[model samples]
Target: MRIAFYGSSLVSAYWNGAATYYRGLLRALADRGYAITFYEPDVYDRQKHRDIDPPDWCKVVVYEGTVEALKRVAAEAAKADIVVKASGVGFADDLLLQETMASAGPSTMKIFWDVDAPATLAELKAAPEHPLRRMLPSLDLVLTYGGGDPVVEDYRAIGARQCVPVYNAVDPQTHHPVPADPRFAADLAFLGNRLPDREARVEAFFVEPARRLWRRRFLLGGAGWHDKPLPPNVGYIGHVPTADHNAFNTTPSAVLNISRDSMAENGFSPATRVFEAAGAGACLITDAWEGIELFLTPGEEVLLARDGQDVVDLLAGLTPENASVIGERALRRVLAEHTYAHRASEVDRLFRNHARRVEAAE
Candidate 1:
């Protein structure tokens, strides 16, 4: 199978958090002997600060995000077995969507891979006449990063012929347990790109906890958080690179996972951080959400906090032995059930089944 995927960035996590997901899943697909070509726009300063060098198995084609460029890639898009336009493709999403649809023949699987299903599904509900609604039925499939039952029902309700959740999973190879780095050693740590959807949650779950734990050290990593008013005990380390994710997760006493409002409301959705942190055997404490039990068993495998006070109390009360035990449990759970290899196999099976079904129908 030849898959042409258009996503935020494959080579650089930079400002694109989906880079890890892309790398893990695509590399797994390549391991299955599928030919994969990832198309990424050369914008958003990602091209300026290139992170990972060229990948070995797949061909990554970076193009200027212009109509002319889209036109040039139409033939290649048409030739592939699947052409996917991921949710947060930044600029030229609409342009690329239309051109990809135009180029894809009946044999090609025109897919919309929604990395942010909660946000996308919310918009579809809020806006009855969303352009995506008109396009959903025309596509071969819709894939999501998170969003359990509600996400699937809503997408189908909104005219999506097929809506599937491909929940975020761990790439054990890149995110397994590692020796701690003293520089990142902290009582608590949170790493996320600062966006409006998540800043308030950060303030409530992360920043406020820092305020209460005056004696304990906290570490903050990610871009756009340099100017936030944080507590004296909190140390903000701007933008920890993808290569250093294991060190960052392993170094902290307990790493924090805060979901955006849309995701929390939707339920059953875990962020990339959840798997990454747990993959490193880091003790995890996340804000309260409805469907988290599907991933981690709270109060046992993972810890839960309802608000600022809950986080503070947990941090203040936790012992090193208890934290280590919790981290180990979560790690075991993730490795057994959630891995990129598992997700990649699912994709392969789904596409194969779809192809076989089509052939039989004829």
Candidate 2:
């Protein structure tokens, strides 16, 4: 099987949170004998802050920002068994989306993979005149990275032939626990970019807790958070590399998971960080969400924080033995059921089912 992704940037995690998910999923697909190609335009200064070099598992093609480039790639897109257009390509002009969708041949399947399900749905609902609205019905399938049942139903209502949720999962080999370094070790740590919508949640969950636990060391890492005021006890380390993510997760006594506003409102959506933290055997302190229990059993495998005070209490109350128990349980659960390899198998099944349906129609 040949799979291709038209996304923001495959090799850079600069301002993109989907890089880890893409790398893990595509690499797993390659391991399963699928040929993969990721098409990314030279936009967003991604070249300036390239993180991981292109791996041998998949071909990474960089296209220039021109009509000629799109024309040149149209044939390649038509040749793929599956071609996916992710929500935010960073440079996908109206013309580009139309051109790419039109280029798909009868044999090639096209999918609109929504990485930001909540935000995309909100935008489309709020603005009926959105460019992608009309394109929804033409795509063969719609896949979302997060957002559970409600998201899938809504997409179908909006005219998607088939809609599915492929939630984020961990890559066990890359995310397992490692020896912690003193520099990164902290009572609590959070790694996420600062966005306007998530500011209040960040303050409520991370900043407030740090303020209450004045004596405990707290670490905050990610881009666009440099100017955000923080409690004196909280350490701000901007933008940790993906390679060092496991070390960062392992170093923390407990890692914090804060959902974005849209995701929190949608319910049941867990980001890549949740699985990554668990994969690293780090005690996870996450804000309460409706569907969290489906992924990790609260109190048994993961700890839930309702607010800043809840976080403060957990930090003060948890013993080393209890934390270790929770971390180990979470790690075991993730390894058994939530690895990228498992997700790849799920994708393969979905593709096979689609193929069978197509054959029946023929």
Candidate 3:
């Protein structure tokens, strides 16, 4: 199938979390012999701060941030078997959405892949006048990166024909365990960008733990955290590249996973880091979530940390033997069930099902 994705910058992970998910899923689809084109607007200074360049796996079409550019891109999209308008594209102007939707012929399937389900749903609910709400019923399918039963049910209630959750998964080859370098090795390390909505959770789970364990070496990596006050023991390393993510994960005695407020509230939403950390055979200590056990077996595969005290206690008491055991179990579980290959197959099945239904109607 020839699929075209119209969303956020696929080649840039700079400050965009969705980039990892996009790259993994698209590469997996490409491996399965699907021709893919990713359409992205050259906005938000993404080109200036790109983390990963366009890979040979997919064709990348960059558009200017204007109606004319979007119309031009939509013309190309009209030929694709599937066209996806992903959530959080940063440049999804209402005019652009309308143009893209109208340009698709009967053969083209349009999808709205919501990478940030909580925020999107919340925004729509809060503002009945939201333009995307009007666009929802017209979309062929709605897919989300995270969220469980409640999310799907809600999407249906809002008039979507179908909604699927393609949870984040690991790329085993890229994220497997490696020898820990002394530079990245720490007693405890947390990696994530700073966002206002997630700041409180970060403070509770990571910053506070660092304060509690003053004598232990701690590291924080990701963009937008330079000005934040850090304890002397906690080192701030801004923007760790995707290439070095595995090394960073492996270097930590235990890696901390902190979810944003929206994700925690929605439940069942695991970030890409959870899988990445687990894949690297790094013991994971994550803040409590509603459906964590569905992804990782707590106590055996991961340690639950509800507060700073919990984090401190876990770090101080987790023996190397126990950590290794937990990491290995988590890695095994992820490899068995949560990889890009699995997600790609699921997507293919959905596309085939949709195709079958269309044929039946015809």
Per-residue error at 276 for model 1, in Å? 0.6
Q: Give all candidates' CA lDDT scores.
A: 0.88, 0.87, 0.88
Model 3 alpha-carbon drift over 4 Å, by segment: none
Q: On residues 185-238, what C-alpha lDDT tens digit does candidate 2 reach at each position?
A: 889999999988888999999998888888899999999889988999999989
- The estimated TM-scores of all candidates read 0.97, 0.96, 0.97
For candidate 3, write residues 43-75 as lDDT tens digits.
Answer: 877778777778899999988988778889988
Please give the TM-score that candidate 2 achieves against the real structure.
Answer: 0.96
Encode model 1's per-residue lDDT on 190-267: one tens digit a residue: 999999999999999998778777888999999999888888888988988888999999888899999989998888
Candidates 1 and 2 compared by TM-score, better number: 1
Residue runs of model 1 more than 4 Å from their true location after superposition:
none
Candidate 1 global TM-score:
0.97
Cα deviation in Å at residue 160, candidate 3? Answer: 1.1
